[model samples]
Each structure stands twice: as structure tokens, then as C-alpha cells.
Target: MNASYRGGPTVERILPNEEAHELLGLVTEIADGELAPRVADFETRGVFPRDLVRTLGRAGLLGLPYPEEYGGAAQPYEVYLQVLEILASRWLAVAEAVSVHTLSCYPVAAHGGDQVRKLLPDMIGGELLGAYCLSEPQGGSDAAALTTRATRDGEEYVVSGTKAWITHAGVADFYNIFCRTGEPGPRGISCLLADAGTPGIVPQQPERTMGLRSSPIAQIAFDDARVPVDRLVGAEGFGFRIAMSALDSGRLGIAACAVGLAQAALDYAVDYARQREQFGRPVIEFQGIGFLLADLATQVAAARALMLAAARLRDAGRPYSTEAAKAKLFATDTAMRVATEAVQVLGGAGYVADHPVERYFREAKVLQIVEGTNQIQRLVIARSLTR
Candidate 1:
């Protein structure tokens, strides 16, 4: 275990080993030197940081939890998530990109056939990027009702229908396509791994997002796109299960991102309050502002602890889906609240782009929506309790 201070309070981390400590230090260095400087420019221009993503992949930050034989670092889930937190503190888009790519690899790495498993090296190694295509325009939370259909053709499955809110749509080398294959309901779905360049696969224009503009999100139209039969992950009717399982881990990743974002906002607000004077004293010295900062700092710490608790359960091979949902729900909601208060602390400067809090405020919102909305997380936890 080691305690280190970044910009805000000292975070005491209980790492599994010395190697994990060194890995966090390395990630911090990369985040400061590589990610921080480019975030503003790339985000402002709505440019995807493809090369920066490649740099992370090359540095082994992209595949922290997969097996070493598959070119992954084989780190524990807890360590992998902390890496995401470190990256998100400097640049959230890149951290999210890493999380999505990791989620995209889960199907193949965990359930792919032998032939498709051969691609793990390239996918996990980050030589090839990937996308998870499970959400649809008509079916974001109701994943079982997804209308994307894949019919069996000679030696292939002809996929048709549109997937909405797909990250890395046009940029990924491969996509994990979850589609309907049988009768209506959860049992009808199947997963297919398809090459991004396959014919009839069209990526729509990127959405003009409020934040995380550096990471593109758009709908992908699969117009009778042909994917090999061998690309089917696990058995037919297993896609829904695979998708939910992946999201359990993905939610934890998002929780880590939220914690990092909130921590950054708190740190900035604290710094601003220390320097900005009001009534012949630093604003931070005032009881009104000091108590608010105290509450925000405590919330950030609690969120991090909750997220790490879920991750450790996962690393220990326990049932953590409900815990993951709880962490995601609490952390993201905390991020939205913390970021809003941070802006309030900054007054007028927070409303403008002059400070990073404005961006943080905007970015905090989508964390509550992605991976699974806060409402949906509540549903998951509720079901676990009753059942």
C-alpha cells in the first residue's frame, strides 16, 4: 500500500504488489506528459486522438486485465481500474476509449472459438482497435428488444439494421455486433465479430457532443453486411448474457472515470478558492466555501472506495454485478454533483471555457448515461435484492 498526493488530497491506495505501484507511477507520467497537453486542442477541434490511443496501447495501458499470453499485462481488475482513474484525471476521453476497447474485447477473449481467439494478440495488443455494438436507437436499456437482425446465409451471417451511439464507429478495426438471431426476447440474440471494412457497413457522421468530442459517437448502419460463421461468439442465443456480463466490468470502469473526474474538479476548485480573495481573505478560508469543499472531497473519496470494492470482488471471482451497478450509480451521481458545485465555487469563471471546470461539468453528465444509465443501474440492484 502507498499514499500519494496528486493535485487534491493524498489518496491512499492498497495495491496488490510493488509492480502495481510502479505501473501507476508510469501511467501518471504518461498522463501528464502525453494526455494533458493534447486534451484541450483535440477536444476543441472535435478531433479523435487516434495516435494518442496507439501510444497508450503500445505502452500496455490498453490491455491491463487480459492474459499475458494474449499480449495483456495480466494485472488485477483493481489495478486496471486505478489506471483508468489516473488517465481520466488528465483526459477522460482517452480513458473512456480504453474502457470501451476493453469491453469490446471481452466476448472474443472470454468466449470466442479457437479460430477467432487467434486474433486476441492483435486486439489486446492494440494493433487493432475494437467497438462494442449492443445499444440501438430503439433499444438502449431494453437490449433484449434490439432490432438489428442477422440471418444465416451460406457460410456467413447477413447482418442488417442500425446500431446507435456506437463509439469508435468509423475508426475501429473490428466490431462486436449483437443482433437478433431467433425469436423475440433475450434468447433470440447472438454476437458476431466483424471486420470494420466489411461491405455494407456504414458509419454515420459523428454527433456534435457537449463533451468528449475527441471520441466520436455515431450510428453504424449494417446493410446486409456479411460476417463469417466462424465469427459467432459462443453459441447462438448467448449474446444477451455476454453483453450483460461485459457491462458489469464496463460499469466499474465508468465508476473509476467518474471518481477521477470528480477528484479533478475538487482539486481545481480548491486551488481557485485558495487564490481568489473576497472580503480581505482567501475564499477557501471562509466557512461557507470551506465546508462545501470538505463535503466534495469526502464524496470523491467515498466514490473511489466504492468503485475499488467492486473491482476487488471481481478480481476475487465473486458475484459483483449488483455491486458494480451500485458503484456506477453512486460514483456517477457524485460526479455530477461534485462538478456542479465546483462550477458554483468558481463563480463566473466556471461558466466559461477559461477553466477546465466548465468542461468537467459537461463531461460529468454523460457518465450517468453511458455503460448503463443511473436509472437502469437502480433496476439492476432492485432485481438483485428481490430475487
Candidate 2:
């Protein structure tokens, strides 16, 4: 069967191949049957669903858009992103985790030496879940200012300091740790791959977040954690470039996520409007409510189109950083607006846990903040324009 979501087509996506269409169909089946049913319960309990993630990995959902030689599907970025969008429509936490996992894989996949690259099979295949450690407590938007130290000692680098706001913190099998290897500033940074079992690496208590409670987020402390020199993904002092490059792609992932979330909220609002009666007529029959839903629907479509356009640019090997930033900014802002409007449409129900709109609303805010805040996205766009 075609990947029909929630008894309707949210977006008319143009698939490049029959295979891509089939892949999306498989994803839809898994999301509907497996992920959707558990989202509410898991979120309510504030539990991390490690088994669900492993299930996704086993189904080959974890490794799309990477080379097949390393156990990835080798799908186009646009195709992979649509899969993410589909997942997000069902459950934002799962989608965000997938995106974060993909981001964590970037340094090793794109920059690692042959020795490190060999680990891609397990990483891309989903056998080893990953986390990224770039933001420290003192540095969030100012990533270059991270003070995590990785001092050279014989064949290993002794790592020390803490990484903050880490996704998949305690649950991940590996971590991509960015540390200071030389002088201050971005030029001193370097990337290192550390196993979760490494000595002196500790994941602190999970943060009680506003949303996405099912996906763990916390600070990781590394007290003289010894990382072998071979674990270095790229040359020392080139990590800033790697981090920036990875974020360019990662932002597009977040944009797609926003599109999916907005689409889901819009769908919920539209459905509610059509069924709920007020004053002897369905709520949707009123022009005020109808127009609001119409505007939200239009915005969702626009966000999806913009995100896909950026993905296509990346797939074409073109300069898509500016477009990605625009997509990330526009789509996330749209998600926030759409989700808020959905809550409005539901009236009292929207404010409570009875409706998923409230959860969507909370989750939408973080997308705008992570992968660089919307304000930072504006700066990236402005910089590109003048340059």
C-alpha cells in the first residue's frame, strides 16, 4: 500500500524512483504500527525507548543517504529527509533521535581515516548508536569557545571537561567528542571518537526537559578520558571546519523535521475542525476558523517545499548552506506557529495532554533553538548575502 498518513495525504511528494516510494511505504508501516502507539505512553513516563531505536536500526531505517558499502542505503539526501519527515509526523522524538544519530556519524563518515572509517558499517547500520559532544555548558551558540581539553599523551589523548545538552547521552554506544587540542579559538579544535566504555567518561543525570522526554538529554563529563590517537577523525585544528560542515547538513535535517511536525499539527487541527460542531454547524464551516486552518496548511506546504529544495541542492553537490539555514529558520518558525494554532483550534483540549498538539507545541520550540538558534540562522543568511 502507498504510505498514506492518518487517512490522508499530507504532501504530494515526487519520488525519484519506485524504490524510494517503496522505502517510504515501509517506513510508514513501521511508524504507524510501532512508533506512533508508544509515543504518548513513553513521553508520559519520561522513558527512553532503546529497543524501539534498535528495531528501527534492524529495519534499515537508520542508514539512508550514506554509501551502501558502509551499510547505508545510499539514498539521495532528499529521499532520506522525506523518511525523516514521515517519522517526525508520527513521533518527533524518534525523528530527532534519528537526525542526531546521523549528525554524530558525520565526522567519522566524512573525515575519518581508513581505520576509523571501518567502524561505519556498525554505526550506519544501527548496531552502535551515537552521540555528539560539541556544546559545553559555557558554549552553546558559540561552539568554537568550548574548553574541553584533549591533551596528547604517548599514543593517546587525555580528555577532560564536560559536554552539555547532549542527546542520547547515556544510551549511546559511541560519542563524537570535539575537544581543544591546541591554542584558543576555533583553530584549536579537533574531533575524537570515544567508545562509551572508555574510562573516565561519564554521562550525568538526564535533564528534565520541556518536551522529547523519551529521548535522553544530559551533560557528559570526561575526566582524563584516554582516547587513542587513531580515534581522531580528522587532522588536529581542522575540527571547526568539520563541525560547521556537518551542521550545514544537520540543519536541513531539522528543517525536514519541522515540516513534518507542522504537517502533523495542521492535520490534527483540520480534522478537529471538520468534526467538532458549534452553533449547529461544524467549526470548519465558520470563515474565521477555516481561514486560519487554510493559512496553516499553506505554510506547512511552503515549509516542506523550501526544505526539500535545500535537500535537492545538497544532493546536487551545490552550495546549500545558505538555503539550509533559510529552510531551518522558516520551517521551525512555521512549526511553532502551526502547533500553537493547533492548540488554539482544540480550545481547552489542546492545552491538556488529551491532545498531542500540546506536546507538538513544546517540541517545536527546541527545533528553533538547536542546530544553531533561529537568530543564528539569520546571521548565517545575512553573512552569505554580503559575501
Candidate 3:
């Protein structure tokens, strides 16, 4: 799945197909023209820019991997990774919302029967947005230990429980709710497609996050929410596997986002270093500062490479869990380090909003925590080592 990239130290130009390059161009254009200008307003006020998401949908960037018949681009994972990377570079909140939306759409798209897939046209066409509900207050990274309960009735499943830290919770058009259906533990879980307006389905106030403010998080409660049995995605016991598979794909998205974040930081640091004079010379002219930029750039390249490798594995229909975990682990940690160093390179200016390095710094921290922590990623990789 690994193919050598051509031209320059900017390995991000590499992709599995030319379509990715074209898609990334659109992403960059949109980011620079639409999102970059509004980032300060959104991040500072913690207000979600819902209108921006619709714009992304209109651009056909919302659903890249699904079949074209469903209004998707039918792009491969490699191409999708680049899109995520580009989006993250401009605004991480937008990039992450797209990632989480895709994650939320997967169970119904891939595993649900034809009836569910039929929804893909409107769903992927940007008419509908989605959220995934798997984490509970007590669960966090211990997803298998989820406590959300669902009881079956004659023709429907009565869902009763709260889902915590749901991205796009109140704003999403649909939710892929994972709840317990059997005895206990992982095997008891199931994925149900619950519409946002369903009776008894409630979205609480959005949580004030440390960063990624343009993307809001909230808790959802299903108080005997009546979901038709037909709404179930895959089979009852397959939810655990379904969730894991979606997360595998999701980790790739996060990895790409991390790459973009690191790229933004590096670009800022390099540009600032070249302009800001220090000791009667440009800062970049100093070997110490030059070497730091070099190292940060190198790490960013490595992060992009790892994510692309995993994305290629996904395109090949191979086991990508270990590789995806590795990519997420490496890329996110790199973003954190690179963002911190980027601020250091900018000195006092970096710490302030006159430059976006501070924003990049704040945004990079969450990449390590969401989509499963780096600690959880290592466990997934180590467990797969025995296999």
C-alpha cells in the first residue's frame, strides 16, 4: 500500500490518485477564502458555524468515500485523507466535524441493509448530517463498557440512556446510537439510526470545550426513544465490531487532521522565523532556529507518511487497525510537539492572537484526546501484536 511520493520535502503532495490532489485544491481554496477569515470569530465566541458545514456539503466535500450513486465522490481513503489534512490546516473544528460526521455515518452506510443505504443519496448529498453516540459518562475510552441500555419491543427497540461527549449532537440530522441490547459487555451492543427529531430523543446544552469551538459537543438522552427494529445497523451483536471498524477509519481521519495541524504550525514558524530579525539577522538564519524548524518539518512529514500508509491499507481492504492506531498515535503527538515548538519559534507573538500559532496550539491538544486517547491507541497496537 506504500508508494513513494515525488517532489520536495513537502510529502503531503503525495496521494494514491490525482483526484486527491484536485480535491485538496478545493479544500485549500475553501479554507483560505471561507474558513480562515471566520476562525477568530468562531473560536473566540465558542459559537458553532453551522452555515459553514452546509457550505462544505454544497462543495461535495462532506461524503467522499461513499458510492457516487449516493451523491458521494467515491474517492478512496488516500484522497479522503488529503481532504481532511487540508481542512484541518485551515480550521480544525471544521475538519473534525467532517471526520466525526463520517464516523457517524459509517455504521448505516456500510453495514445497514439496502433501505438504509438508500438514505445515502440525501445523506451524502449534504441534505443530512450525522452524529455517533457511543461514549457514556462512565465509558470514555472504555467503549466496550458502555452503559446505554436498549430494550426490544414488538416492532421497535426502546432506548433509554445518556450518550456523553457527542460531537454534533443537537445539530446533527441523525445519530448512530450504540446501546446495550443483550446481556452485558461488548457483545450486547447494537447500532441504531436515530433521527434527531425522534420522540424522547433529547440533546442537552453544548459543552464548553477548550478548543475546536466551531464544533460543539453535547450529551444526548434517549428516554424510551422508540426506534424501529428495521433501524438497526448490521446485526445485534455486530455493533462492537461495527464500532471498531468505524473507529479504524476514523483514526485515519484524525491522523490526517493532525498532519494538517502540524503543517500549519510549521508553515507559521518557518515564515515567522524568516521575517523576524534577531541578533542583527533573520531568526531562520540562526542554525539553532533553523534546526528546530527542520526537525518540526521532518516530524510533520513523518506524520503525514504514517497516515497515508494506513489510508492505503484501508483502500486495499486489508486489516488496518494496527496501522491506523499507529498513525493516530504518531500524528497527534507530533501535532502537539510541533504546535508547542511553533509557538516557541514565534516567541511572544505566538502566544498572542496576532498570529494563529496560539490557536494551532490549543487545537492540537484535542487531537490526542479524542477518537480514543494515545494511550488507548498503544493498547490497540500492542494487542494486535499478538495476532
Candidate 4:
């Protein structure tokens, strides 16, 4: 089913198509039955759910937006967006982890040589998982300043340095590690695939983040790591551009997830307001409570519109990187705001662990930081305008 906006009727209520309905059902069932039940426990423990990810892979949820030739469901980005939205409504961390996995696989699917292309059937096939590594200790927002080095040695390249804030760092089967192989700065960067368990590629302890605890962000250290020349994602010196391009689309995924999380928060808050009585009546009956609901509804709707607009531009093959940056920046910020406001609406219960809004509040913060920070998004937009 297709929905006009976030506040509008759901796809099931508006225009439920067979494909959308089926995908939604699977995501909702899995999220509700598996993720929803265990998410709090996992989050509190700050543990990664490796088996759950593989289960999604087996269910074909991991490759929903890729091409059928490569064992994907061949769904459009629009449908995939809805699937992500549904998942995020239940658990933002899980949805984002899946999104990161998909994005990590993009370089190979889009730029790999014939031999590499043949691997897509298994990679995008969901049998294998991937991670994208670009951020480093010295370079986070300034990805161009990355110091991770790759020097050619015989048939392979010796890679060294570290990549920080890598999602799924330890559990991923492979990584699209961006390294400097030529001149300094962005032009020198090149993307290479390194197996997680390979020598010299060490995933250190997972970062104890403020939120998204289960996704497992970490620093990957590479000391004299050797990468096969054939593992290059694209031609030498194209890593930065390749990484940036993947992030363009990847940001949209974050936007969609943020919108989903915000939407869920709004939905829950509104329901809670209706049920929670105030001095004389239901809190939702009062103007103050109604105003809060109105504001949250507007924010969620606006964020969804922005996300879909960016997605449509991508689908049309337009230059959508700037638009994507805007979506990610604005939508994630809105999510954080909306989630916090939702807690306010919940009053004392909001402060307690009785509701998921507390979790939503925590999850929203990471969206602003990943795929590029909000500050970097502004730079991309500004550069696009001036260029």
C-alpha cells in the first residue's frame, strides 16, 4: 500500500498493494515477535544480536532493495523505505543496522569488476553481510583527511591505520574500507574489501554509545593489513567519491528510519495522551495536549515528505546527494526533537522505562551523527548550492 504522508492513513488503510503488504507483514511480524520482545533486554545489556541479523538475511529482509539478479527481492526504494519504516517503528537500532549492512554492500554491487560482480548473488543474496568503513579517529566529519594508508606490494596492498565508529564492525563478514592510496586528501582515497577476521584487521571493543547500544559501533585497527588488489571496490583514487556516493543514498536510509522512529513516538504519545486522564478529563482533550500532538504530527509528516522527495529524486536519477543530506539532517533532528517532546507529553511515565519513547529518545541521537554528521550535511548542501 502507498501512503500520501506520515499522518495520513497507513498503506494497509490507503492503498495496500500485494508487494507492500507482504513486505510490511514480514517486517512487522518479525519486529513484533522477535525484536520487540527482546530489544529492551538486548539494549540494556549493550549486546549485538548477530543471530537476529542472520535470521533477517534468511528471511530475505536484508536485500529488499537490491536487484533480483543478485538474490534480492528486486523491490523499489519506495517499498524498501516502507519496510525500513516499519522496522524502525519497533526498534530503531535494528533497522539502522540493517540499513548499514545494505549500504556497506553498495560499492561492490555498483562498481565491482566481473569477478566481484559474481559475488553479489551471495552478498546481496543475504548469505553474507558487509560494513562500510570511512570514519577514522583523525577524520570523522572531515572524511577527506583520512589517514588510513594502503600501499601496493606485489599482488596485494598493505593497509594500515584505523577506521572508527564502524557499525557492525566485529560481526560483518567484510568491510568496504576507504584508504589513502595516492595523493593526500579525498582524491587519494580508495575503497577495498577486507574480511573481518583477516590478519591485521582488528575490531576493538564496541563503543559504549549514548544510544543504539546493540548495533555495535567500534574502531577497526589495521596494522600492516594486506588487501588483495582484486578486492578494490573501484579504480584507485576513487574511494572518497565512491564512499560519498554510497552515503548519499545511505543518508536517505537514515532519514527514513528517523521518520519511522519519530512517527512511532508520535503515535504512542498521542495514544497515551488519550488514555491518561488529567484533572477533569483525558489529556488529549485539552488544548495544551492537543497542541503537542499537532506539533508532533506536523514534524513527522514534514520529515517523511522530505525523505520521500529525496527518494523520488534518487529514483529519477537526478543529482540527489544534496537533497539526501538535507533529508538526513532535518529528519534526524526532527526525530530527536519529536522523541524528546513525546517524553514530555508522557509526564512521569515518560521519564520511567514504562514506555518505548525513552528508547526512541536514545535511538534518535545516533541518526544525527552517522552517515555524516548534521554539520557535514550542511556543508554538502552549501557546496551544492555554490557549485
Q: Lowest summed lDDT over 10 consecutive residues: which window, candidate 2?
A: 1-10
**TM-score to native of every candidate shown:** 0.98, 0.98, 0.95, 0.94
The model with the greatest lDDT is 1
lDDT of candidate 2 at residue 308, scale 0 to 100? 89
Clashing residue pairs in candidate 3 are none
Per-residue lDDT of model 3, residues 195-303, tens digit only: 8999999999999777788787989989999998889899997899899889999999999999988998888788778789978999999999999989988899899
Candidates in order have lDDT scores of 0.92, 0.91, 0.85, 0.83
Candidate 1 lDDT, 252-323, residue by residue in tens: 999999999999888889988998999999999999999999999999989999999999899999999999
As for TM-score, the candidate ahead, 1 or 4, is 1
Which regions of candidate 3 fall more than 4 Å away from where they truly are? Answer: 1-12
Instruction: Give the range of the ten consecutive residues with the poorest summed lDDT in model 4.
Output: 1-10
lDDT value, residue 385 of candidate 2: 84
Clashing pairs in 1: none
The CA lDDT at 371 in model 4 is: 90
Residue 141 local lDDT, model 2: 95
Whole-model alpha-carbon lDDT for candidate 2: 0.91
Off by over 4 Å in 2: 1-10
Q: Is candidate 2 or candidate 4 better by lDDT?
A: 2
> CA shift at 370, candidate 2, in angstroms?
0.7
